[model samples]
Target chain A: MATVKWPHFFHFSAPHSVVNTPAHRPDTRRSKSYGRSCVEPPSLFWQTPGHLTTLGHRIPTSRRAAKSHNITTKVDPEQVALLIKNEWKLSHVTPLYRFRHTQLKLYSKHLAAFIIAEKQQGVAVEVGVEAGFKVTFSAVLGIAETKEDAETVFIQVHSKPLFSADTPKAVWRGWLTCVNGDPEYLRSLPPDFVSLPLFCSSGPEYLTALVKSWFERTFDCSFGSLYLNSTMLNWLAALWTGCHPTSNIRYLKLAWNMPSQPPLDIAYTVNPQDAWELWNSIHTEDSTDDRINIEEVQLFMNGLEIHFFRHFKIYLSAGTLTKVSTALGSAHHDGKIKIGSSDYITTLLTLLTECALMKTPV
Target chain B: MDEQARAILQRVIRKIPNKKLQTALRAWDHLSSEQLESLDYAQPKWLFLENLISRCEENRLSLKDVTKLEMAYYIDNPSKGTWHAYQLFQAEGDAVSVNFTQFREQLKAHLKDVVRHVSVRTKKLEDGAVWIRIAWGDNFSKPNHLKPTYVVHYLQTSYVFVLNLMSKHKPFLYQALLLSTRHVSIKEAQLSSRSLTAMRDLLMRQYQQVFPTNQERTLKERNAPPSHPSIEKEHAECAERRHQMACEAFGDGVLPKLETAVYKLETKYRGNSNNTLNDKDELFRGVVMFSSSNLLESFRHCVSAGMAEGPVTPLLSSITQKGRNSFVITDKVPGAASQTPAHKA
Candidate 1:
């Protein structure tokens, strides 16, 4: 028989095993039976066959056998690392585990780089990511110190569209790479990150509700002044954020572009108490020092009346008499109230005269 | 008498009714001898014959009576021949003599019946004449020709007459008639333009005697009851004055103003047309065209040379201005007025 050399193995005595026992003695009979049955044992369980074995017995029979037999061979530590790195590159490694390790390292590096780059760029960042979506990548971008110093940066990535759409996983992976590569580039993004569609949206109601929830989640963050254009969305955000109490939102703009006939109902969603609170805040603040201009207030009032007349009436009642008078005068000056009928003109004139008289020093 | 003359005379007598002839003749026969003698001979003779025949036809007398009377008057008189010659001469000179006698007989008969009817109808007016009064409303004036006239007739025993009684003032009568007729209620009887003119004319005519002189009363002065006249006359004058004022005010100027104002109001409010006046704005244009030839002659009757600021002034001015604006005064070509001959020379 030709002598065979087995692969090198490390050996050590069992920590708790007895040295001599009749059961532990080598059984030649069992060994011959095991040889006749060529079926290999499970790789992990294969220890020593029939108590004692020749060196040839320890060696693998074929190349496939050698693969199974080599499991016990002591692997070099550097070689293991190299092997893992190579596997990651091939993408055979599970993406979750790879993401976990890769984002953590990228986050640390980008966080430092973003902090330095944000100082140079006057622009802001807006990051939006939903959970279970690109949130993994967003989380990495959000952690960057440079992204934090941005004048106005939003980071939000919705998970539902990214995961559920027909997009390939590779595309998301590519997005993840782009987002994580540079936080400085993201901070230079334009103010209007998302362009609104020309036509009215069917999903405004849904989007409004989501935005309300978002406003609530982000209430504590320093978002500065928010100008929400949608009437319903702004109203809902105002309610959910609870910023009315503290007046954190110094300026709010609302736009309503509904048709003239069958005017919209805005009172249903807006709370009277919230409106009163907003009006009271406006009154308590010095009119000269107000950040919101009179024109902006008029625009807001116009939108309110257009969308919700009843709510606007209530708002007017809650508003300061001075402001109400000013608004009424402005309305008359603008010819917003059509002077078609004699009776209507008389009624308007009466109301204006009454208001003017009431404000006069008696 | 000639046979033809006799036939014509008989035909005329037949036209008189029997009952009227009987009454007339009896009155004629009852005439006292002194009265008959006091009458002119020719007239008495004609009357006697006419009455006698009329009585016979009425059956109050027989033909014998007519014959006896005629023979006694003609044959018994010795100068009968001369009388006959006078009668023939009168007949020849007058063509209507035969018919005149017959008509006289008929008038006598008619007068008798009228007198009897009046006496029976009005015992109080038996001795004198019974006067019948006729008054007409404004609208009736046009058709009836509201003029007062006296109709007199003498019967054997009494006289019958008809006297038209209306407002002494023509304008008063006209307005009163309009007020009484056109309106359902007294309030609605207020005089309108057309009625006003009629009333003014009526008043001016009717009250001419009371206000004879120009110094008698001016429009405003006449407003008060006349102090110079008796109470009854004063009341009449006052009533006349009021009627006149109403007519003049509503008719002369106010009505035209009111019409224009109503037209403007309708245009502004109701959006309707005023078709009451025949002389609409268009007619004024024709007047202007005619008037343009002799300005002085055209304006001769006009109160002023320049247009007065009145109801029609604005309309006239607007028309005049529009005409002037549209009028193009170009240089007259050599023979523009005379058209060139169709057959070129």
Candidate 2:
């Protein structure tokens, strides 16, 4: 049996962007206040000016700004297929202390046994040997941008449900991976730790929580809930809208929270061509095809808001942008996401990684 | 009582609710204690005011003294107006040394020095909160009592809450706050609540907060998670963890009520696109507000619940992690404008 592996930090020096609009921020004194202890052995990494700076709209790194590049061939098609089908809930994991990839098989056996033991409470279930549920852990390679990035690990849970003769159906899917994490921050951690901060899961509520708890016990790490705010949804909408000319992003749909007595939810669905046109018009001066700057995204959003106001006598901007969707992907402010296409999966992953890293208590 | 009798106390007396009339009068401290004891508050509201106005006329109180009555009412019932919090940054040396009385003196002197046409009244609430009421005017006009701004601050904390402050007077008020609190600058905390108490409690984390520990939870609490064989949720430990995380991020039990969290964006749009607002120091000036009866509680529910696809993201978890509901996103990398990863959305 093959053992699970972790993501590699390939492009360790590569800088990443942060998420959210203007959310309230506390000072650095509360750094990693969520986790039990963020005590990393003092190293040369202390020289870099670090604090909550990495948590917000931080200092951008590359000499050439972040532009979307085609990473389709490098990533596994099967992995992309699994991601694009379902919406994902995101959680940020602290550095996994003493999380040995070499012992993944052992961990899998333990988790499977744990599930069985948990399912039928108070029963002395036989450990190992595939009980009622089966848990498999596998490495997903080629997704990491830098060597400092831990290679991705994918986990699946399958159940027979008394199938006896029927094939056991897959019940849960989740992965732990980080792309374009701050190299300085990753390096600063104690060598025993692997920083795969981003954890995405699709499964039953109890199962997801159980898996998370098991990881916490084994790895000495805590998971945090991260919701994508409206600013992020707008960013996603524009990013997908820009991909319209390259790949057909069937439609641009957005949801908002109205400033009403009983908070109202409003959704706007725009034709792909119209959104693309508005997007192109906003970026007429840039002439660049690959780069979709935040300013352009804002302007595109503003155009839609203006149009919406003209019709309904409501300033859509006055309402918070709660969710944004296209044929490629849809992200909710509540931290739910659907990756409809694999073309922009890398971009999506990269964005999520920054978010996860930002939540890292260290 | 005719207008003649009521005029002695100023028209603002009617603005005070009939229920709080006694407290307001007592706080005003204008009339003699013996006269106050003699007044019959249970009588018809107008008759009560008539007897009070006759006493005020005998005392020869001025219109300025009448505004004191209003300030007293506001100071006692702070929840009557909306309060916004501002953070005092770069506070140096012995910031918390000043007591409420000392702070009042410092503030009044500082405002008087900065601008002549201003009246500053300071009162310390029983709860250790220092309330400052300021009526402002330019060099030409006197301090306007009709639209005064009230500020509340606790000596130990860096946050200062204010109510009914106009934009034009923010700088003056900020300067007075800096000098009085010994802080370098004052900026909006971006968190506002319907009442002053709720905002303080939320900021101070004075409620039941959940945290993860090595010890196991009670069997009863663990079993609280809904159980069904189909979803295989028989594991109560997992559900407990979600609840713990949610409670850790946002306090459980009766949570503090915050009406709104407003984010004022001065962040550079770093999409690397042709939007005119990009680069050259142009910021995407925008505002986003999240409002609810209990914003923190609602946020906790969203984070705790499982999404159809997966679960909550880090962005959602950041509110509690950062410990602030208000933020100003700026381009930290001033020169390297093109750095984009993770932030594409």
Candidate 3:
């Protein structure tokens, strides 16, 4: 049924609980023991369900907020600019089977052909720059924090309508990445799979669906929307507000929505320095790791909510923290994100990945 | 009829609409068919009640018989109040069972032995739901039908759905349930719904639950879309695996309808020190709740449509596996709190 070498179809034959790292165990060093997975391999995919087990899901117990950095100097500035500009719709992709970063150019041709073919039933359309929709798949290099981490794959679709300009302009852009992905989970894979857990697309739903379908067919992976809830939005807000000292956040802007009889929306803006001062007042860092706890983050948000309540006579926490934006970038609770700057991209993706992992079935 | 019994009967009959009187009486099946035919159900509610009380008086009905009619109404309207589910844990490997008669005797004996003036009545529905109505009284008062707790449990399953239970009587009720069912202890299962039957159907696994199977999924060649021969699916294996995983995590077809899943986090605030919640002596408590018109359906779509990555996380899967939606996360492991009444996940 597939163009890949394997004829027989394989499903999640991997045990839900692949390895017991004790990484999430409170008070343990939060390092993924990469060597352990190599020593004790997950029961092979070809193995029976009887072999499947649960050591418990690999979710982190604690995490630190994103610190400011200059990612453009380390990565391609063009890629950084492209990433920071578009408000990408986020989804989590299952591990891709036999996806090789070295062969993205070939993948590009195949995907473009597949998309064109799907769009026009049996029409003979030669897929390339001349084609109405030209797809380009490139390796966004230097995002992988470990050897096990696969190079991020960036995809762009250029559209040139029948009577439009001669030059084909980019109509859509997306990327699949795993920056500082759970090393244990990446290592646990049988080596044929690429664990790119985060998928972000900026395009029309129609074209995005086609592209996703192509990726699903070609790579044999699945994608699910990753909705960033209000808690996550609050996390983003506090984290970005913390970055104001290093890189001016301009103004900390927050939007909230509560389901009242008439429905209410609150858009609160605070001076970057004021938000930063409030964050510092509540965010006490006694440890050398310079980490911020979930409690402190919640407290910082509470301080804002209380302040808002004191002035406006309405509790903001009653509604959702729908949107949080600053000089760094903006993120919506519905899972759309504009990077604004590449500095904290890893931090955002890492948090998203962790949040994604928390959805494991009971 | 006894004065108390007459008042209880009057109130019970009044609660039922004029139209449902016949069906409710038939369900009660206490009054003779001839006597039922003799009365006028279409008369004013007060007249109807007075008429019914005279008939009961002529029959010399006891308090117990009057309670039967009240039970009948409650049994008909199982949707009277909100029901919370609790799972019973047995100490040993072998699960224990009790027949209807034995359970009734044991429950009545346990409650009567504990409280002097307590009134406990048991009735079994056709679908094996044992409905127990208990009226409580303090040292000075007689058992009051005005305030009664309804306990519903399927004889075979471990769940007990209680409606309007007083916290003061919880340990006593738990004791009775444990003795009646031969289970050791009971803990809140944290699942609640307005419909008692919904809770029962969910915990009892009345609906189908999908599991991973070795059967070949033969995709009909006719269903394939016409394609330009140049493009082909390189990784059909993954698509198949994800579909199967989705089905396994969330059952195929119409998913179970659960409106909410709440988690009360009482775990220690293990964080960077100097945080107010990081008190070593006291645990930090927070509630994370997910609500939708149909929560399980939403989660199923989240899994099937690829909003949630596979293999499904234990937290979401715990909904079906634990047959529960509410969880209390404590000092134990993060996933452990959602497992069962007693066993940690």
Candidate 4:
């Protein structure tokens, strides 16, 4: 009955301490309106439907349970690269990098808040911070935590802050090589470096390489669990999986309402021709006891259009199904039909029949 | 009858066209002695003379119809200048003799066409008036966008006057009046009864103001009769004064009455419940009524003064009473009763 934790660790820092303290400091003036009061912890953990497991609790490690937990974790370097390559195949990777750079540039002009979350305990912690702050409290906190646990930390010094500022190109080149070329060097860096809110004011591809290198050098891990929000994690996972060529990453959940403006163009990596074949493969592989995850099925259906119906019919013919109507009826009950399809009427009729059978008082 | 009177009568007859003069002579024949006296001829004893002179001038009556005795009667009345003048017009010429005869005929034809067009245009106006009355009763009515009350009022008043005048002077013109009122409801036409009464009152008031009897006249007039010093001048001045006064009184009284009657009728029939009388509609109705009434009165004055056309008295009487009575009867029972001889009689 333990609730699943989102597989992300978040490090948050604001210019002013949001925490309320009664102590008066002459240098730092306090405002009464600064902090919100914390609510009391619930009496029972499982009483609430949406509560996550408490810290230090063991997460379910079974593949099926883990997959259902809404987090994808990778423990191998080859697999991480493969995922990244797959993401690149699926989207226009260049535009993604360009967009990331633009966001960084725009955010640099204001008082910024930064958060970095790590998906795994010992995998290199991800580092990110807003561009402008006189003193980054997060960097200071990391230093303090490192000092407290010096015996457990091993720090590999790559580009110091001064070197990054003075010789940026050289530092960038070195950072890139350390991340993409030398796995051992990347694995040598301390996990605390990940905890430090590092500045990334460049393209997303560069930032991705830097982060991956930092993790490899710091923890000798190619990929552990992703610790970013759904969008970033989806992009990185797709990249690792080699599902697409371009890295224009789209997280299905986040895609519902993203981009303050509508995207100029949207491209899907899944071929319209292959959609029917893929759908048939899923049905053939799935057992009566095993049900298709409705979400993946819906996403697949979203990419299909009228052009795929002919191929889909062919796929249906190849399968040893009783009557096509019965098969479609069951499929329709499962909500597998795309709502916006031109064949909505036909599909809806089939779906109704399927739903009736499923709910036939058995 | 003297030879001079016969020459004058001949001269008058020469001035008038034959056809019109014939009609006038026929009308004269029908008049009683009192009616002839009311015309106030200069020579009373020369009645036959005046009558013969009037007949000789009538263009409508052929010379073969007149006896030598009638011509001899005309020779003796030397002082009957007014009668002679009327005969002159009657015997003047055919339609070609009068400069405006052809034009008048054209005008009549054009007017007939206009009557057809206006019937169509005025349908909405009449309907609007009816609707206003049905909706709002006698309360103040708003002007309609399609047909303003002022225009409709003017058209109705003009139409009634024209009918009256045509029936009196030229019975032929009655056809046009009938055509004009073809589509007008019996109720709508009867509304003119109120207008006619108002007009009669206005004319009487005007006549009294202009030519008051010696008793009712000013002291100055009594002190200095027509025989007194500057008698001719005084008479001229008095007539002028009377005319001015009549004009003013008619303008003030008759015009407003016509406007009020039209407004009341429209309000009783077609006014919208929500709309109230706007100042523009009131001003427009006032101006139109005054102008239309003035036009009719001026035309009547011209006839009375021997300037233009036939007398309007017969036409006015015919339309105002007969037409209005017919409207009342038909309006009372619009269907079966209208068809019955009992109602028609």
C-alpha lDDT values of all predictions: 0.24, 0.67, 0.70, 0.25
True-vs-predicted CA distance for residue A208, candidate 1, Å:
24
The predicted structure with the larger TM-score, 1 or 2, is: 2
Tell me the spans in candidate 4 whose CA falls farther than 4 Å from its real position.
A1-40, A43-46, A53-224, A227-362, B1-345
Candidate 3's residue-wise lDDT over A207-300, tens digit each? 8898888878777767778888877777788788878778888888787765442244556666676667668768776667777777777887
Best of the two (1, 3) by TM-score:
3
- A best-first ranking of the candidates according to their lDDT comes to 3, 2, 4, 1
Q: Candidate 4 local accuracy as lDDT?
A: 0.25
The clash numbers for all candidates, in the given order, read 32, 37, 14, 68
Residues A261-289, candidate 1: write the lDDT tens digits.
Answer: 11211112223233333344323344343
lDDT of 2 by residue, A1-362 (tens): 12212222211211110121122232122222221122423332244544434455463321122344555688777876776778688898987867777778888788887877778797675665455788888777778888888888888888866537888788999889988787777765545568899898998989999899888877767788878766567677777777787788887877777654335455566667766766766764345534556666677788777654422234555567888888888888778888877667777877878777876654
DockQ for every prediction shown: 0.00, 0.02, 0.01, 0.00
Question: Which one wins on lDDT?
Answer: 3
Task: Tally clashing residue pairs in candidate 3.
Answer: 14
TM-score of chain A of 4: 0.19
Compose the digit string of candidate 2's lDDT tens values, residues B82-108.
Answer: 788788898788786877777888889
**Model 1 lDDT tens row, B1-345:** 333333333443343344333333333353445544443333444464464344334445442233223222221121211100000111122223323234334433433332222100111124332221122223323212123222222222111222232324323322322222222111111111212222222222222222224433464574555566778776675455434432322222211111000001000111012211122221101000111221211211121211111222222222122211011112225868321111111
Per-residue lDDT tens digits for candidate 4, residues B1-345, read: 344346544544443344434444443353344544544333342564466555345433332223222322232221122110000011212322322233234434634443332211121222221000000011233211122111112222222221112112222223332333332122123333324334433422322232334323453543344555577877655554544433332221222132111110111111122222111132101000111333334423333333222323222222222322221111113445421111211
lDDT string for model 4 (A146-241, tens) is: 221111111111222432464322111101101111122212222222211111112234434544444443332233221122322222222111
